[model samples]
Target: MTTHVQLHDRLDYQSVAPLMAELTAIADDMLVIDAGNVRHLGTLPLQVLLSAVRTRAAQGKITRLAHASDNCIDMLGLFGFTPETLTQPEAWT
Candidate 1:
């Protein structure tokens, strides 16, 4: 089954632990991350997302991002990532 995870508006350092825990809980399932509300994508949260993507890929599950906001897209771009690129596990490596 595909599980949808909705990202917070402020994905800063404070959100890392909670986000990681949420993602980890769904590690065995196909994931679709909803990024439409994301206003700030901090490095730590980005790392958490990357880790989740890699883990899902290794387990032969899919991880995708959906409905990304413009700010979220820009923030990802600053780190050389797009919502599409984020889903590719190889990109993280």
Candidate 2:
């Protein structure tokens, strides 16, 4: 089952351990992590996202992020995450 992750709070530079865990559960399915309303972005969030995506990808399943903010894009680049709109693009802002 594909799950849509809509984010509205601080995603960057914040500990997403709790969020990560929740996302992990749907790792086996198509996941959409929405960050359209996010304002702050940081490396930690990027790390968590990458890690989660990688983990899910390895299982033949993948995670996707959408509606990312500019800050999200910067963080993705800063963390070396390539251009994947749903994964690291600021479509929302």
**Cα-based lDDT for every prediction:** 0.92, 0.65
**In model 1, which regions exceed 4 Å deviation?**
none
**Candidate 1 versus the native: TM-score?**
0.94
How does candidate 1 score on lDDT?
0.92
Residues 1-93, candidate 2: write the lDDT tens digits. 878877756764445776677776773468877877666666666667666766677677756767777766666566565438435333313
Q: Please name the candidate that would achieve the greatest TM-score relative to the true structure.
A: 1
Ten-residue stretch with the least lDDT total in model 2: 84-93
Model 1 lDDT, residue 53, Cα: 87
Q: Judge candidate 2 against the unseen true structure and give its global Cα lDDT, from 0 to 1.
A: 0.65
Cα error, candidate 1, residue 41 (Å): 0.4
Clashing pairs in 2: 12-42, 13-42, 65-86
- Please report, as a residue range, the 10-residue window in candidate 1 with the lowest summed lDDT: 23-32
Name the Cα RMSD for model 1: 1.2
